[model samples]
Target: MVEDPHALFDAWLHEAEAGEPNDPNAVALATADAAGRPSVRMVLLKGHDERGFVFYTNRESRKGEELAANRHASLLFHWKSLRRQVRIEGPVSPVSDAESDAYFASRSRASQLGAVASDQSRPLDSRETFEERYAAADARFPDVVPRPAHWGGYRVSPERIEFWEDRPGRLHHRRLFVAEGDGWREGMLYP
Candidate 1:
């Protein structure tokens, strides 16, 4: 077994991607604003490594604003197909512009346009208003759309992670790794 839980997580994620029938990279990200009010919603996992987990969003969005105010965050991945789940809590930071640009360029043309068109987490009058802006964006950038300044990515460097698996009895298996001052401390938990 790999000594580092982060490395083990990467391995498990890879396995889940291969084994799961759908949205293997989907994760529920949780963040709190300055007021300590928490919010969570599902987002796709863009990248992961020793540094952290990466996901993209509009800088002006509520989640983005919250992350900016407080860099702490948590994440959860539930794989029903494998009856397994992983939870992570960590510090958040913006990804490099180069990274954001690369990911934005890889997205579909319409998605690129939508990123520019939508004022994410902002109030809108109607669907017509939204579609009108979307159409305008499409017309404005008929080719080679540039990534919006407001759109980018965030990476969470985990301080703790928990892995859970279902067992025959009600006693599910649970393992957790906590970040110590310079390294990680691992332990098992009763389910």
Candidate 2:
């Protein structure tokens, strides 16, 4: 019976951070193309707030292209250790360049070079070609690696949020929160 879905999500995320052995912020992002073909992939959740959840990727990546065509997506966060999960559906929008720049700057130097070298979602003849490209990027930017123009972040403004917790005897607790005018309308879902 939580009034704030964001707050509940934050609390659950905190618990996951403490309990989950690996990437606690990892989430499955689902997207579709203009023709409604669906695709799902795992991405690290970079940030979250009342506005929405954020993640960064190459704008030319498969997921990014799908997002551009559809402009809406769903996210699923499952914490096996906690036997809990969160589902989010929302419209997607690009984050500001400033935000993307800041996050890009925080990444390791090697990662920065990889981001620049990769022509994500594009065909590559061989691994050596990619290695060469990466090497070139490394040599070109010995000091500061600038974030590529095609690399950026997207925010998903949630329209619906659902929380599920496992219980005994095949029973489970499921709560759904739909965005209302300025708040949320909470309800229960059979599980």
Candidate 3:
């Protein structure tokens, strides 16, 4: 009787952290514009709780633009080592400025510098140009690099969550949780 998707997600995430060889927090983020043209890319899950799944990005990036145009988004977490996947659909909202600042502060100096230097989804004339920009940013912030204004996080407030686990003979297990008021209603789906 797992009524709370967060609890289930936590359990699976812990398992993934132990079993996955690489980034356990990696997730495929899907976003679409108002016209329904969908796009997806990989991003690291920075945080999660009852509030929803959180990931940071450049607000000027393609995904960020799409999120702004249409707040609806979806996240998929797949741990091939465990043969488990979780799908979450929800509306995304910007995290508090304080939250973004805190996370930015926690990041490595190089990462912070890179965030400031990189133009994200924008085109680059050459790698050297990008590196030069990064070098300038690096020189600008020799210490205590501040988070760029365009860099922040988004939280997907889930309306529905589905958990899938592989089973023998292709008889997989699937459970779905739909938000209901302050709680959730769980149901099993045929797999």
Candidate 4:
């Protein structure tokens, strides 16, 4: 009986980093509106620990809005080279403003400007307009770009996590971890 899901995730992620050619940290974040309509998009996993999986985005963006409406969310990670994927379902919550600001400060200057310029998930008139706005932001903040109030991070506090590994002949392995009393209860599920 595996005890710690985070430890297992870390081990698999380390292996995926070595095998996956592209973004090993990429995960599909799934959220729903108040009406329960679902939407999924790729987001880079910024940080992960026992607390939750965290990713930063503009609060006005579609996912952020959806998360605001529906606290529950899901995440999926597929690593083709490693023939593995993980599914996570949990309630989501916003990270502290300090955390978001620190992460934003760690970003490249161009990225900071772009974050300020981008009205993420909103329609843009033209690429030129976006570039203009981006340039304006860059000019406005010649030294340091402050993190926009809408730009921040959210953490999904996992209630359930399942790890899957593909195998030949369609036979696969599935290990599920469900949060229990002060710990996790592991179960093997059919694939």
Task: For each candidate, give its TM-score against the true structure.
Answer: 0.95, 0.98, 0.98, 0.98
In model 3, the runs with Cα more than 4 Å from the true position are: none
C-alpha RMSD of each candidate structure in angstroms: 1.4, 0.9, 0.9, 0.8
lDDT of 3 by residue, 50-111 (tens): 99999999999999999999999999999999999999999999999999999999998889
Identify the runs in model 1 with alpha carbons over 4 angstroms from their true place. Answer: none
Worst 10 residues of 3 by lDDT: 1-10
Count of clashing residue pairs in every prediction: 0, 0, 0, 0
Error of 1 at 83 (Å): 0.7
Which has the higher lDDT value, candidate number 1 or candidate number 2? 2
Per-residue C-alpha lDDT of model 2 across residues 106-149, encoded as one tens digit per residue: 99998899999999989999999999999999999999999999
lDDT of each: 0.93, 0.97, 0.95, 0.95
How many clashes would you count in candidate 1?
0
Q: Which ten residues in a row have the lowest lDDT in candidate 1?
A: 1-10
Error of 4 at 90 (Å): 0.1
Worst 10 residues of 2 by lDDT: 1-10
Candidate 4 vs. truth: CA RMSD?
0.8
Better of 2 and 4 by lDDT: 2
